[model samples]
Target: MSLPDLPTGWQVWNEEPDGRVILTFRPDVFTEDEYPAECLPTIYVTNGSRKRRPGAGQYQTEEWHVELFLEPEIEVLTETFDTRDAALEGAVDVAGRFADGDVDPRAHYQIPREDYFAALDRLTGDE
Candidate 1:
């Protein structure tokens, strides 16, 4: 159990000046580590519109998106009722989908980077 390594097309981009970090995953690649057993893929990072859904208010809505950049060969994963540890394990298992080869740290989820930044900016008044 060390976690699957990042597949090709997965990458991370950091913008310290903007206080931002992004994780991107190609739709073609996937691993049993992150998804374990699920269907709906979610972006598992901070700074985005962490809120699952927004109301009718004027709040700028931006979901923490994790698009399936995987090639059509791979199927997307979704969430499940696994134990917290199991769920987290699944998340970690798929960690490579969001790894930063340039840095030692890896992203926690498969969410795209730019959307994460935009969601954060809206929250921190950077918007």
Candidate 2:
């Protein structure tokens, strides 16, 4: 129902009563005009228990999960937690990691945008 405490410069991007949340990092810097949609550092938390099949096995258990995306189709981190609070915490943790330069968005995919990478580095204080 409630969002988690995000890292510095991060804010809630989207949320739903059904327990779907999205947090975006440094919205002031990662503007739509300057950065592509894929370059956005986003953390997604979702709980879709009702969507799971009844006869599904243990692996299909409807538990909370936090996914960290450095870019579109590029999930750099995934963590599962037993409780929603834990999942939210995981999301915040990943956000901190991203700001700390522990995660690289461009490493996974061949992004030729030098300006984007440079802006990202500046945003994260790497430059």
- Clash count for each candidate, listed in order shown: 16, 0
Best by TM-score: 2
User: What residue runs in model 1 are displaced by over 4 Å at the alpha carbon?
Assistant: 1-5, 14-21, 26-43, 47-51, 55-92, 95-127
Query: What TM-score, computed on C-alpha atoms, does each candidate reach?
Result: 0.24, 0.76
For model 2, residues 47-110, the per-residue Cα lDDT tens digits are 5442346643224346887888767667877788887878888888888888877777666666
Residue 113 Cα positional deviation in candidate 2, in Å, after optimal superposition: 4.1
For each candidate, C-alpha RMSD in Å? 16.5, 4.6
Clashing pairs in 2: none
**Deviation (Å) of 12 in candidate 1:** 1.3
The C-alpha local distance difference test score for the whole of candidate 1 amounts to 0.34
Model 1 C-alpha lDDT per residue in residues 1-127, reported as the tens digit of each score: 2223344444443223322223344323234543322221233322233244664322323322222322222324433422333433444445443332221111333555464444333322345
